[model samples]
Target: MKTIGLFAVIMSAAMTVQAKQVAPTSSKISPATIDQAIRLAEATSKEGVTKKITIVTTDNGKSTDVSPRYTVYLGYNSMAEMGNISAAYLIAEDAYSNVTAKRLAPGIYQVQYKAYRDEAGMVNVTKVIDANEAFINDNEIRKACADDFCDGTIKAAVDVQESTTSAN
Candidate 1:
C-alpha cells in the first residue's frame, strides 16, 4: 500500500511538471464591425442629451443647485486615487445616465471608454463636471471597512460628501 501511494505521488508531480500553458486568443477587428459600432454610437447619441447639470444640494436647511462647471481634479488628492467603482449621473428626477468614473475614485476604471452617450434616453458623461467623493467612496468601499479607505483623506472626503448629499 505505501509503495503504491509513493508511486502515485511521483506520477502526479511528473504530470504537473509536464503541463503546458496556453495563450489567450486574440481576434482581428474587421472594418464591417468597426462601421457598425460607429453607426450604433451615433444613433445612441441622438437619443437623450444633457443640456446642463443642476445638482441638488442642501445648504443651511435649504435646497439649492450647486451645478457650477466642476473641475476634474487630478493628482494624488484627485478622484484617480480611489479604488474600483461605478456611477450613474442623475440627469433629472427619477432619471440616471450611465457614467464611467475615471481615476482611483472607487468604482469602475476603464481607459478608452464611451466618453458621451448620444442624446437618446439619457445624458452621458462627456466631461465630469465634478465628482462627489461621498458617492465614489460609498459605492467603492465595503460598508464594514468604510472607515479604512486606502488613503486617509479619500475616505474622509467621501464620508463628508455622502453625509451632505444625503442630508438634502
Candidate 2:
C-alpha cells in the first residue's frame, strides 16, 4: 500500500509538470489600440454614423510577434468619411499598436467593439464580445448589429448541415 501511494503521487506530479510545460499564454489587444478604436467610434457616432472595430488575432497564443497586424472597417455612408477613418486608424496604428502577452489559456478570439459619445462628449464602449473563428466577411456576423450599435452577443459564423453541405 505504501509503494502504491508513492507511485500515484509520482505520477500526479509528473502529469502536473507536463501540463504546465504545454500551457498557453494570454495575449490581449493593447490598451492604446483599444483607446484608439473607442475614440474613433465616439467621433463617428457623434456625427450620426456607426462603426465597428473587428480585431482578428494572428495566433491562438503561440505567436512571438509583438506587433500584431490589424484591419479596420468603417460603416461609412459617403466618400468624405472614408479619408477621416483611414487617417485616424493610420495615426493610431503608427503610434500605438501591439499586444501584451501573459500566461493564460489558448484561444483564437475575434473581438468586436462598438463605442458611443455621451452628452458630455465622453467616449463610452457600448458593446464588446468575443467570437471564436468568426467569419467577419459573412453578412450575418458583419451586420449582426444595427447601424447604431451591437447587442453584445457572440454568434457562430457557420451552421452545421450534416446532410447537404459539402465537406470541402
Candidate 3:
C-alpha cells in the first residue's frame, strides 16, 4: 500500500509538471503582424517611393552581396505643422547613395538610413548609415521604440494577446 501511494503521488506530480511545461504562461506576438507593421511603416516613408538600395554581408573575412529585399521609410518633423512628416523610398543593394553599411554578422545585416524632407516636400535620401542583423528583426524594432515613434498602444495590444492566451 505504501509503495502504491508513493507511485500515485509521483505520477500526479509528474503530470502537473508536464502540464505547466506544455502550456507556457507567456506568449509571443505573431511574426506576420510584426512584419506587416514594419512593411507599412516603410511604405509610408520616402524610401518606398524610390525603392532602391542594397544589402551586403560578410562571412569569415569574406564579403557577400545580398539584394535589398526590404524597404525603409523615414519620419521627420514637418515644417508647416507641429506634427511630423514621413516619406517612403526604396533602394537596391549596391546602389551608390548616402546609405552606409554596417556589419551585423558574417552574412547578416541591418541597414539604417536618414531621410530628409524639404519645405516644399521634396524628399532627399541617404543610404545605409548603420547596419546590424539584430535590428533587422521585427521584435528588435518593437523593443527599440522608447519614444513617440513606437507608442504604448502597440505594446498594449501584444500584452492583451498574451493574457488572453494564458487565460485559456
State, as a TM-score between 0 and 1, how close model 2 is to the true structure. Answer: 0.17
TM-score of 3: 0.16
lDDT of 1 by residue, 1-168 (tens): 999999986565331111111111122323332211111011111312211112221112212542322212111122223232222232112112221233333221211112211322222222222334434443344344454543322332211111001111
Per-residue lDDT tens digits for candidate 2, residues 12-109, read 53311111011111233454543222212212344443433332223223235433243232111111122212101111121112322121222221
Collision pairs in model 2: none
Model 3: per-residue Cα lDDT at residue 84: 29
Off by over 4 Å in 1: 1-85, 92-128, 134-136, 143-168
Which residue ranges in model 2 land beyond 4 Å of their true spot? Answer: 1-120, 124-127, 133-168
The TM-score values for the models, in the order shown, are 0.15, 0.17, 0.16
RMSD of 3: 22.0
Query: To one decimal, what is the Cα RMSD in angstroms of model 1 from the true structure?
Result: 24.2
Report each candidate's C-alpha RMSD, comma-separated, in the order given: 24.2, 19.0, 22.0
Candidate number with the higher TM-score (1 or 2): 2
| lDDT of candidates 1 onward, in order | 0.25, 0.25, 0.25
